[model samples]
Target: MKLKRDFYLQDCVKVARDLLGKVFVHETKEGIAKGIIVETEAYNGAIDKASHSYKYKRTKRTEIQFGLGGYAYVYFIYGMHFNINIVTGIEGEPQGVLIRGIQPTYGIDLMKERRKTDNLINLTNGPAKLCQAMGITKEQYGMDLCNSNLYIEEGISIEDKDVDITKRINIDYAAEDKDRLWRFSIKDNPFVSIKVKS
Candidate 1:
């Protein structure tokens, strides 16, 4: 079943951690592609230095974050890749969870075609990679997650013992907030992005 908006209205950290093992589905004109969420990172707006809306800053790129929870915050990065994030928290609060990794569960052939590879690790191992493999683009920005073509759904239940927590990746620029343990992954999940440093 599709997750309700209330599921994303809670704390960003909670939603990020709980998102592991859920199914992320994206339906496009080409076909339906789905994957089990294996990794995520939480960004608490205003207070989170790593967030685009940090200090409550609102720009055209971040305006959607301040809207109601359960929306897609798709954005282009590095001038080439697109990353998909789920907006969370109440309207104007601007918290979001980055979907870092997913384990392909449906439309594997379609994902491989889009990614141009059959290697499981290369399928949807990172946020940008998953967006590409799942045919998600910046056009999906602001799409409501609660009831939209792209949404998360119930999948296998992940146990606490099967989870691993670590600092987020590629955001050392956040300074002191860089070390915060906001990244969560399913323990031993090969599809998870990268191994957390010890």
Candidate 2:
């Protein structure tokens, strides 16, 4: 079953941990592709120092991040790659979780077509890469995940022992914040991208 609307960031930590084994499904004209969420990173509210809303300020790019939870806050960085984030925390509090990686469960051929490479190694391993593979874009910003064309679903139930937690990737610029250690993932999901340099 798909996640219920009531599952929005009521408890950010629990939500992050629970997402470890959930299946995230995205449907497009190309086809339906599903992945088991194997990795994630959480950003807490304005005071968390690691969140984009740290100053409690809003910009065209961050407005959606400050709104309701469970919405998509897709954005572009490094000029080309789209990074997909799921808004979390209480409304107006402005926190979100970055989906870092997933294990492909459906439409492997379609993912290969969009990525232009049959190498599963590069398929849906990182955030920006997954967005490309799934056809998500900035146009999806603020779209409600609970009801949008692209949404997360509860596919396979995993035991707590199967999930893993570690420091997030690619935030060395955050300094002391780098030690916050908030990344979560499945212990051994093959679809996760490991060759990419963070």
Best-matching candidate per lDDT: 1
Off by over 4 Å in 1: none
TM-score of 2: 0.92
Q: How many residue pairs clash in each candidate at the backbone level?
A: 0, 0
Local error of candidate 1 at 54, Å? 0.5
Candidate 2 lDDT for residue 87: 87
Tens digit of lDDT per residue, candidate 1, span 21-99?
8999999999999999999999998798999999999999999999888999999999999998999889889899999
Off by over 4 Å in 2: 194-198
Candidate 2 structure quality by residue, lDDT tens digits, 41-110: 8877566566666768688888987777788989888998999888876777888888889878898899
For model 2, what is the error of residue 74's alpha carbon versus the real structure, in angstroms, after optimal superposition? 0.4
**Poorest lDDT segment (10 consecutive residues) of candidate 2:** 189-198
